[model samples]
Target: MEKYSTNAINADAPVMLATERLLLRQWQRRDLGPFADMNADPEVMRHFPAPLDTQQSNDLAARLCQLIARDGWGFWAVETRSHAEFIGFVGLRETKPDMPFGSCIEIGWRLAQAHWGKGYATEAARRALSFGFEVLALEEIVSFTALPNLRSQAVMQKLGMHRAPDDFDHPAVPQGHALRRHCLYRLARGAWQEQQP
Candidate 1:
């Protein structure tokens, strides 16, 4: 999936956004270790099919980096302002056309196990949503996770995304896999603006 050329505000520059406590910036080489460690943690990977090995994690990171480099925005690496510690990643990405919701940009996050419950996901997501609407002028953004991933659902709710009525089987997950079923949440630009101060 690719970002639209007509919508991106930073099409030629490296992407970076800041929150009160976090910095959402381009992924760095130093981020791979922490990123892989986070991916390897079973507790953190519990919602997915399985934990990613080091090579898988590094490969994923490289793709994310390339997307940001190409489109000027993707799932940016999130770090702290005070500590500059790489907690994880949070940002927007384009979903494949075949995804349950069809082609659209979606918000996503993955944080280190140690960083759970710190409001980092919500804070960084809020900024990402703002960029999606204000900067990219997107019409909508959606998020989804396995049916059992209520933690991620909570973050979606925090961002004012309403649960879609139907559940769908994620094609990417193998048939009969426990994580195959997913719930979707969406927020439209008009609704998002109404929710803002």
Candidate 2:
């Protein structure tokens, strides 16, 4: 998936964005431990195929940096501002053409098991969406999850995205697999701006 050049405003001084409880920022070398710990959780990987090891986590960090440099958008290392501890990641990615949709960018999040249900995903996602449209001037942003992933779907809804029923099976996942089938939800730039409080 090739991400388009973004006009998203650079975070002044790279200062982190603070939600009610979370902080979104660039990944740090120290983030590897917590990131690996989160990826090693089986329940967290349940929605996907498998948990990643340390080497995978390290590689992912490097890869994410490249993506951020190239597209000005990538998964942000998320933590708690109060505690200043690493929790997980939340941000955006280019929607693969293989994915079931038109040209799109996807908003996504993943938190450690301990951080689940803390509203971190929704809060951080709201900030990312703001950066995308209000700053990047994106035409649209979308999100998707497996048919069984009601939790993620709820988060998308909370961010004001509406379900787009014309979905297709994810080619990345094997056919007949539980996670292959997905549902897409989208929010246009105008619609998202109007929903701003």
Candidate 3:
């Protein structure tokens, strides 16, 4: 049976997930500059709507922190355990403003160009799935990205998320926007556990 329970959910949850080469933790004030730089890079933001400015990056981080403060799990700042360099973030987020699943969460990730092809996103995303299914006991977790963002779609496939037929224009984005046409993928708790190595 799918293990979907909200009983373990709580705000004020601790952050800090460490892998062999990476550390996923809460966003720090000092990390904002580099984070902003990443978000502002056209190459990095190519799949996004547009490059974000410093204030926008700060606001986004603040909002993510607040979400974690309220819901117990949110995007995590990803860094190298060896050098402690902030490369990107990965975690779970609620689908907002005309969400497909209605009161459901999704797993997502973003990485700097310098960190691309390094498998950091896939590695961190795997851990995030562990937290969602094994720890949080979430029933299902979904991920969505622009139809053209095949890199992200590849990562989702690597993490074992199956594509859904329904394509929705993201309400938060303007209609006819390139980023608005999104393809969704989903993985149920039982399927996730079954696919584990």
Candidate 4:
């Protein structure tokens, strides 16, 4: 028997998620400056090819907003509840269709280096996953990262996603790049349910 029904993708929800210390919401103009700075941080962009310039970071943030405006949900802007500061993004992105696993939606995050050890990624991600598996009623949500990105991989494991056996080369990464090879992790709705209290 199929473990989960196919009724996924709720038209609403995921617009905004508020956790104990964070809020995930649509992008705002105030977020751009800090976002650009964060993207420019070499340590923050360590797994990627290089840090983003201001123009590139702004363009990327704009694109994320456009996606949210169209789909009602995406890698929403993350901020702190106490200070109400723009941190970074944490949510989902739909991968390309031709990949080995086919087109899949993945949960991901990026925050300022200052916020690294506070469990912000994990906390915000839990809300995102709740939005994905519960609000959207998705069958599965996957997360992937460069082979050396142990920090992101750690978040995925904390979310209870299992590491899949078949690792794949990322199409976006240039050939022979150290980060081209990626690790995949997945979480099924049925499995997420088992994790519930």
Candidate 5:
């Protein structure tokens, strides 16, 4: 594994991991503007209910930072190694208890629309999965998305995660919300190890 860096806001915060082309690092002030812009973009937020306003975007970023500070890991702020630009986030986060796959760690990613189709999500997520299995010693990591989010599901498949039989409605979303219905995917630690050389 490549050595990870910790050029975070402070010593308390640390860069979580690195991939060949990306760094999964602690959130920085420089990330806020692009993050808010990405959250506000309609096309980027299309799979969700609606785009986030500036405050909501800031709140979400704050929460992600807090989670990482508390647990030493969460959805990490991702940057391109070449330009050191903050594109978005990709890492592991604790799944909400109300969800069908209760109390599990999940791997997820969201990048600016301009950064899509470059295989960044898959590359970063593979690093996150390694952290989960190798460092955290987790048995499995799960991922889920609204049924229509085939693009995200494709990433899960590429990472060797298999869909589970049960699909559930996301409790946080309204009961009848079009995006409430979600598909679950899981990757066992053994399965992840098998994929390695």
Candidate 6:
């Protein structure tokens, strides 16, 4: 396994990964407001159970920052290079214990509703996958979403991840909730390397 420096990630520093149009960097104080707004938007949170309030959003951002600081990589705060606008986050995170895929890395993204339909999510995710396979030396990365969230599933397909036979109920969601059932997707490092030029 590849190891990253345990030194706390500095949010103010420039990111190590940069796509042509985006920069996946550490979280900054400025990101909280926009992240909170994004989390509170019903349209944006439609796949999840409910929209987050300001406090809940801030707490989530704080937890993400803490994870990055501890692990030296995580769901990085993503921004457009041209405008430096905080669109959302897209990167790799360790799957929570409650998830069926234990002790595995997963790629995920959440962007402001206004930023949807642009190629931003796909572009940023491609870069994140490279970091996972090349930099982190992970054997595989997985992604899952509420079965109804075809938009995210489309992005997963664009990244060349295949649908896995195992569909799981998200433990974080209520058992009978409509969003509890999630479609799982997986991409092996060899498969990812094959797609690269």
Tell me the whole-model lDDT of each prediction, alpha carbons only: 0.93, 0.81, 0.85, 0.89, 0.88, 0.89
**C-alpha RMSD by candidate, in order:** 1.8, 2.6, 2.3, 2.9, 4.7, 2.6
Per-residue C-alpha lDDT of model 2 across residues 54-172, encoded as one tens digit per residue:
99978987887667655555788898989999988899877766665655788998899998887888999999898777666678899988888889999999999999968678878
Enumerate clash totals for all models, in the order shown.
0, 0, 0, 0, 0, 0
When sorted by lDDT, best at the front, the candidate numbers are: 1, 4, 6, 5, 3, 2
Highest lDDT scorer: 1
For candidate 6, lDDT tens digit of each residue in 91-196? 9888877788776889999999999999999999999898887777778999999999999999999999999998989999998999999999999999999999
Q: lDDT score of model 4?
A: 0.89
- Give the backbone clash total of model 5: 0
Task: Give candidate 1's whole-model lDDT.
Answer: 0.93
Lowest lDDT sum, 10 consecutive residues, model 2, at 6-15
Across 23-42, the per-residue lDDT of candidate 4 in tens digits comes to: 99999999999999999999
Q: TM-scores across all candidates?
A: 0.96, 0.89, 0.92, 0.93, 0.93, 0.92
Error of 2 at 174 (Å): 1.3
Mark the regions of model 1 whose C-alpha exceeds 4 Å error after superposition: 1-8
Model 4 Cα RMSD, 1 decimal: 2.9
| Candidate 5, run of 10 with poorest lDDT | 1-10
Q: Mark the 10 consecutive residues where model 4 has the least summed lDDT.
A: 2-11
lDDT tens string, model 5, 85-157? 9999999887777887678888999999999999999999999998888877788899999999999999999
Error of 4 at 6 (Å): 12
| Top TM-score model | 1
For residue 140, what is the lDDT in candidate 1?
89
TM-score of 4: 0.93
Residue 21 C-alpha lDDT in model 2: 79
